[model samples]
Target: MTGERGSEQGSPVRNGAGPGQEGRQPPVIAIVGPTGSGKSDLAVRMALELDGEIINADSMQFYRGMDIGTAKITAEERKGVPHHLLDTLDVTDEASVSDFQRESRAAIADIHRRGRRAILAGGSGLYIRAALDVLEFPGTEPAIRQRLEHDLEVSGLAPLRTRLELVDPVSAARLGDARRVVRALEVHELTGRPFSSFMPVREYFQPAVQIGLEVDRELLRERLAARVHRMVSSGLLDEVRRLDSLGLRRGRTASRALGYAQFLRVLDGEADEEQAAEETIVATRQFARRQLTWFRADPRIHWLDWQDPDLVAKALTLCG
Candidate 1:
């Protein structure tokens, strides 16, 4: 599963204040919010205050050369604090939640080893949940995935959905969509277990704090629109063009990023700048809505109005 920490194979547990010492470890502070909600700013400030290092949880920000559209924090914006997992992968590479979890755990452990706090920040709820809850997924077979891919190409997702519904009704109910059903079925065919059954039970790092940023919907919409305009002005189209030249046009997960997908359409002559920007804003707004839904369902999050005067103080109190 993406973001779940498991026991290290062949590694011995240390006594007292050492690695894997959950009982004696310092808590990780996770700052999460929707895209365009200033989570990077908040995380940087929190890191400065708490002597923390940041581990990125956003899925899209990991790719190289995606700076403007993903709104990756500049080195100056990082304010001399160490940030991990940004711009670490090429666009041709595939990144997954499991990859994030493994890397993030190592980074967090290193931060703790250096006697600094670990700050997890970004807008990807799945990545954040994987880190916090330590959920794990079952392994899949390549042949099963290949067969499912063929089915998707020939009969579409209906056959896959029916197969998954028979094998993993709980996962089928939870997924409820064609693409997800196909994926679940692929995993079931590979592992012989319900996809959802592989999920780890909820777990938490004690003494940790979670801060969520919220804004008025209209305000967020305006911000998203303005951000899209700025990105276009900043050569986002050129960036997409370069990525497309690398044979990452569509269907790939990296190509599906809000700005990249819209601009790819522009390059295909299917849309103009204005249309691309409009579509990007609409997609981004929907993504933000989904993020809010995911975070709001978690009872542990300490909600903060984006304009709160004493937000940092409140977060520090929770961390203590």
Candidate 2:
């Protein structure tokens, strides 16, 4: 699924090409790839090499007590580079893409004002787009949203899903959860347009370069499995247990995280640790595949070998 890069080596990577961005700034560098593909490590290395700070694009890392399961970078790993938007939410708070876009743009502006380059890093594809792309979120109407949510509560997702399929089949095919389904219907009700019509075009809101780490599918599968096993070995259950006590199960988003969900079942006696580990490994691999599919569709990202010894240097060249 690999695609050709839009810019070549040493070519000036275009920034702020979207409409109304006349005073184009230096590109905000973003590192993107599937999970367990060493994105965090590479991001830190690039930040140090370029004298930049990091803005997290991973939604799962937003929760305060979700470190181990999300594989969040430690303080030492940051090596003094200020990372924004990590651990900014309680487990009970739902993550919002619109909120993330506002916060990330603010952070990017702050970093640039301080004369430091802004580096955005994470495997969350949509969050990455929200930060760097010229994307618009549909406004929500309180009455419409409340009504759809009430419908979802009373009749279940089937009715809402059917309504979405009739009004906005593209989103219906794409969105599977109750929350997103209700959101799609709400967007349609509010704007009288298909939810998919608002998908971001290939235009940057600011000067930006995306560097994607390419991995062999089989090798990535192995790495993800190994990583899940390591998380289990390194007190992931204890971390999940603690978060669960702090209202993890009450969280609409955090409770459904890949590793955390599987282990929460283990905590409830529905599964054992071994069963949870295997389930998490399988789910993580599937998630990686979905991430690859989303990223590969974008032709602007410069792809690099994850194992390349000079990965940072290559990425820097792309950033120019």
Candidate 3:
């Protein structure tokens, strides 16, 4: 399912290595952490050292023109390593984890075909799992989905969340968005099964390694707060102004992105820029906490201190 390899440098993993190339090692690396934990930086370092490529698992990085807020690494930062799946979607379009699973698998396979290491990096938990694990997506009935959407629009998320709470408290508690709430209801209505039943067990679809960056909670909070300030100084407001012209508010997913959602208020004159920036920081810190909680539950992840000078070497050791 891998897409075309963007470079011709290294040998892919062993399974797909050609004749006389049985000795070549295929790398499947996942770098996961909180939002401001320097995951993209470490991923780039690993790619350069291992002759690998990066596949983005962060849902926000998928949107074009969302660079500054998502903290997307620049082209120069990639340092000639071929990065996959960034800036692939319109800001107005919603990204589906299942679609990401299909595309990222293809990209990783293609990276393997080229005999290069495949590094998956991002803070998005489910998207990362959907790509690297044996996750199955439930089928959606268009009519059922339409009805749910209708109900959400008419009655708001309360009724739908109540329904989901009755059928599946776990999913109801886990999900925060109206869209996802409606989806859980749809799944139950369609299959007579709780939405949680579709969740994949903790198992990889292929041989893989996960490197998690661990941060001190207070330090991470300060870092996240500082990062939000930098984004504002670096023109997050202007970026939102640009995307707003492209129907960002109408977008079901992109509209809800931490910084984007808050700044949209600024544009509408609902709040001042400083207020928007403060909200973004608060929201980002909460997001980072949730991210840490999610990754901590996975037993397979190898945790590394975020500030360790030899973090890359430590992560490499785990790959073997």
Candidate 3 structure, TM-score to reference = 0.87
Q: For model 1, how does the per-residue alpha-carbon lDDT over 57-168 read when each residue is reduced to its tens digit?
A: 8888888787888999999999999999998776766667666666777888888889999999999887786576646655545576677788888997777777777899
Highest TM-score against the true fold, candidate? 1
TM-scores, all candidates, are 0.90, 0.89, 0.87
* C-alpha-based local distance difference test score of model 3: 0.84
Error of 2 at 5 (Å): 35
Q: Please give the RMSD of candidate 1 to the true structure.
A: 4.4
Stretches of candidate 1 off by over 4 Å are 1-20, 205-207
Runs of candidate 2 exceeding 4 Å displacement: 1-24, 152-162, 172-178
lDDT of 2 by residue, 1-320 (tens): 01111101011122344565436457899999999898888889888888899999998998888998999999999999889999988888778777777779889988887878899999988889878888777776668878988888889999888988899999999998787788778778877988788777888888888999999889999988888999999999999999988999988788999899999999999999999999999999999999999999999999999999888889888877
Judged by lDDT relative to the true structure, which candidate is superior, 1 or 3? 3
lDDT per model vs. reference: 0.78, 0.84, 0.84
Which runs of model 3 end up more than 4 angstroms from their true locations? 1-27, 151-178
**Worst 10 contiguous positions by lDDT, candidate 2:** 1-10
